[model samples]
Target: MSKVLYIKANAKPEGESKTFRIADKFMEAYKKHHPQDEIVTLDLYKEDIHFLTVEDVMVHMSNEVEEKENPMKRYALQFKSADKYIFAEPMWNLGIPAILKAYIDYVSIPNITFKYSENGPIGLCQGKKALNITTSGGDYTEGMAAEWDLCDKYLKTIMGLFGIFDYTTIRASNLDVIGMDVEAIVNKAIEEAEELAKTF
Candidate 1:
């Protein structure tokens, strides 16, 4: 059976946040289409992920030369265990939360999740897909706001390292602003996410 890993980065749970709601809708549709698939969820908000220290980086670097195991190897194993990935986070400071970034740093190890070649970097975690679901207080579509979207770009690049090129994004923006219908926008995003989950 196919395995999907849902990584929830939002600090709030359930009705407390809109990003969680969107993720729920997408997962529901995905499960409906692939009932036999196995689902794994990594709730980063609840997990204590530490930032990579200088010692950690040195250990990884030494492992590359000596071909030895590093302490951060478990993070890479967790990332490779899934056939698909889903990141549920809110756009914070034009990017993702610190915990999600820390998690990526821990997992994105060379020769484990990826490798360097003469031509370019080659991904080790192949045949996987990803879906990114985010919510923002300001509208990021078109001319509504500045296009400084770091969350999407960062997630895409990280997933690319694992060869997860087939991906989709569901966004709900302008929640804190007035003159926009919040319910309508959220419902539309949910509907679109449900449709996208079918093919995922």
Candidate 2:
């Protein structure tokens, strides 16, 4: 059975957050489809994820530090070990949450997720797949507003650096738009998510 890492980067709880509403349904469907697979959930809000400090940098750079003793290495190892990844978050100010960025910093270590070579940086975690579930108050799918969608683009780019090219995104947009049927939009995305989970 493959190990799947489900990372939650939203501050809002279930039922209230649009991102969670869709992601939770996807997780439920995914579990039914892959009963034997192991799914590990990492809740960023509940976890003690912090910004990378000088000590964190030193731990990885120093040859004297034991791999087991390095706290940051644990995150990198966990990320490298996962066969699949699911990221759930809501777009905030055209980007992802700061805590989520912090989580990425911990997992993205040279020689772990990637390594620099003569051809420049090369990703180590090849053959891994990723699914990103995102929600935005304003529509970021098309038209002029699409340029402002930094959240999805950023995630895809970063994941690519880790050699995960098989990436998919399920987005629920325009939830806060006035006079729109918010429930219908979200429900539709949830339905799509459920279907994707079957083959994901």
* Local accuracy of candidate 2 as per-residue lDDT tens digits, 55-174: 987765654423855767877888899999999999999999998999998888888888779998899899999999999989998988888899999999999999999999999888
At residue 2, give the lDDT of candidate 1. 86
How does model 1 score by TM-score? 0.90
**Segments in model 2 whose C-alpha atoms lie over 4 Å from true places:** 60-66
**TM of each candidate vs. truth:** 0.90, 0.95
Off by over 4 Å in 1: 62-71, 143-146
Clashing pairs in 1: none
What is the alpha-carbon lDDT for the whole of candidate 1? Answer: 0.83
Please estimate how well model 2 matches the true structure, expressed as its whole-model Cα lDDT.
0.90
Q: How many clashes in candidate 1?
A: 0
* Each prediction's whole-model lDDT (CA): 0.83, 0.90
Model 1 lDDT per residue over 37-86, tens place: 99988898666567888987875564463233554667677777788899
